[model samples]
Target: MRNLQGRLELCSINTATLGHREPLNQTIERIARAGFGGIAPWRREVEGGDVPRLARQIKALGLSVTGYCRSTYLPAATSAEFSANVEANRAALRDAAVLGAQCFVLVVGGLVPGSRDLEGARSQVVDGISMLLETARECGVPLALEPLHPMYAAKRAVVNTIAQALSICETVDPDRSGFIGIAVDVYHCWWDPELTASIATTGQANRILAYHVCDWLHETNDMLLDRGMMGDGVIDLPAVRSCVERAGYNGLVEVEIFSAQNWWQREPDEVLAICAERLQTVC
Candidate 1:
């Protein structure tokens, strides 16, 4: 496994860790100044803004866009809604290209709006990715299927395991042209019994796109928030990273925490400093 050893350049920060408290440009600046090598910005952060200029700015600061945070929900209630969602994802891919992102992260949506068809929603997800593969290929941005934890299966994502994401990749991009892959977020995947084997399979296929880190609090009060910082929760992060490394994933180790009551309340600089510190130590 790669050692961070105080090497901030080997790490990235998803802006949500700071709760989206500042403008995206300012956040990018702060992240670069803090010595992180990359930033993963939410799409909402770029809406109605100067994308090309911002991309240039991020480049000038020497920070790469690790991945664009997330695709629009694929399993909507209506055909028009699903088409619109696909279009939105296409737009996101275009922007990711302009920003020179390494990959465009896909948080495939769960059960369709107002329905209980789990398998149906998953079908939509696969179809949506198939529809977007051409755009992703054209834009030169890989579609990274980030499987949210199963708890999010009802709303956020239907693909909740590395194996599931990999299966989707094989189905959509069987030749593995690098247009589709998986983002392994520890918070979501740490509990899978097939974690190691599934990840190893992904590695053999070269489908691991990004690796996210955040501790799952033992008695979390909120599902969305309450993410523990490195070493604060019970997850053995090092073990997860080892599995990821053994899978041949050599990308930035991204820190993605949603601590509404704790880290979000602190100064962004403080939060960043701690992230860097923990990346060198606990994580």
Candidate 2:
């Protein structure tokens, strides 16, 4: 809705896109130089030292925060493991707050080893989210439930649909007080038959937290990496963004790629330039 003319003020860069080529701070500076609206960083980049200082750096560079990289890896065999994840998430949330992030993205973990309890894994997800919501609310930062692709269901996320994530949002924070929502990453949802409907539903409920961009490669080299660039792949991004727009989301379209082979090997500035160009022409 913000860019009805196809002018992209919503373009952002996830630092992982250039993770292999540069350090986090340099990536942030490069992203700012490339003219993206925001950056979403992984937790490791901020954990070692002064997060507020890094926050100041990001702010001074005139870039905004889309969300923090990740939080939820809750599924564990032992109660101690679950509690440890909760504490880790809480600490991640605090870092997000310090970075002045709008939301903290949650990549709910997969099943415990040797376990076939999909339902139990989901239960752990729900419980973990419920526990974290209060801290998220207190910090005035939202918790973004990223429904990873079904390909990741075995070891990444139990909630693999926009419908499922929204259901959690309703159950945990029904008011949609902007405290709970979904991160709609196009790479994960473009293949879904129910995606458009889900986006519309998310819009009506105001549960769309952050929108991420990346192309899904056709060859499918690796399950965890091997993402495609915007125009290089088959995704109709503008159409997807339109669905997100229709769903009442006016957030940054954060470009997140885990391409171990392609984008990561390129120079950081070159990658940013391509991301910007692709955003304008194709996205």
Candidate 3:
């Protein structure tokens, strides 16, 4: 395991941690100034123009682009909608390549609207990902499938476990070509009894594309927004980190917190500082 003690270079910041209060350019500057080794920006923030220029800016600041924010939702009610969603994801992959991001994250969609067909939604997600794999390979941008917590299985993501994500990867890239893999987020996965084994399997397969860290509040107010800072919640951060390291993951550890009421209310600089401090001590 890489010792992060006093080594902020292993740390990366996902811009959402800043609550979208600053512009993308300013966010990049602040993250770089805050001494983060990398930054992950959302698609919404990078959709405007001159993406290559933006990439250059990030590089000029001596920071890496850890990963692109996300791909479009894969499951839809209609064939046309699903095709469009796939195309949108293709575009995001292209953008990720231009930005020199390590990989493009995918938050696979859940049950189609007005439908309880969970199996059908999972099928659509598989097809969507299979369709995008060639483009991702062509662009030299890997795809990271992020399995959200089961709590979001109904609306956000149907791929609710690391095992499930790996299943999809196996189906799509049986050769383990590394074109598609899984993004392990502790906030969504800490409660799983199989986390350690699952991470070990992912490591053996060499499919751990990205690693995200944040705390799960014990008394959560909002399922979507209330995330606690590291050391302020019940998750065993060092244990989780140990799992990833034992699994042979050596990538940047991204700090992604979506706290609408707490961290978001504070200044971005302060949040960055605390993240750095907590990462060194607790994480």
Please list the residue runs of candidate 1 whose C-alpha ends up more than 4 Å from where it truly belongs after superposition.
Answer: none
Ranking by TM-score: 3, 1, 2
lDDT of 2 by residue, 57-83 (tens): 999988889999898599999999999
Model 1 RMSD to the real structure?
0.8
Per-residue lDDT of model 1, residues 239-276, tens digit only: 98999999899999999999989999999999999999
**On residues 81-185, what C-alpha lDDT tens digit does candidate 3 reach at each position?**
999999999998999999999999999987898999999999999999999999999999999999999999998999999999999999999999888999999
| TM-score of every model versus the real structure | 0.98, 0.96, 0.99
Better of 1 and 2 by TM-score: 1
Task: Please identify which of the two predictions, 2 or 3, would achieve the higher lDDT against the true structure.
Answer: 3
Full-model lDDT for every candidate:
0.92, 0.87, 0.93
- TM-score (C-alpha) between model 1 and the true structure: 0.98
By summed lDDT, the worst window of 10 consecutive residues in model 1 runs over: 107-116
Range of the 10 consecutive residues with the lowest summed lDDT in candidate 3: 1-10
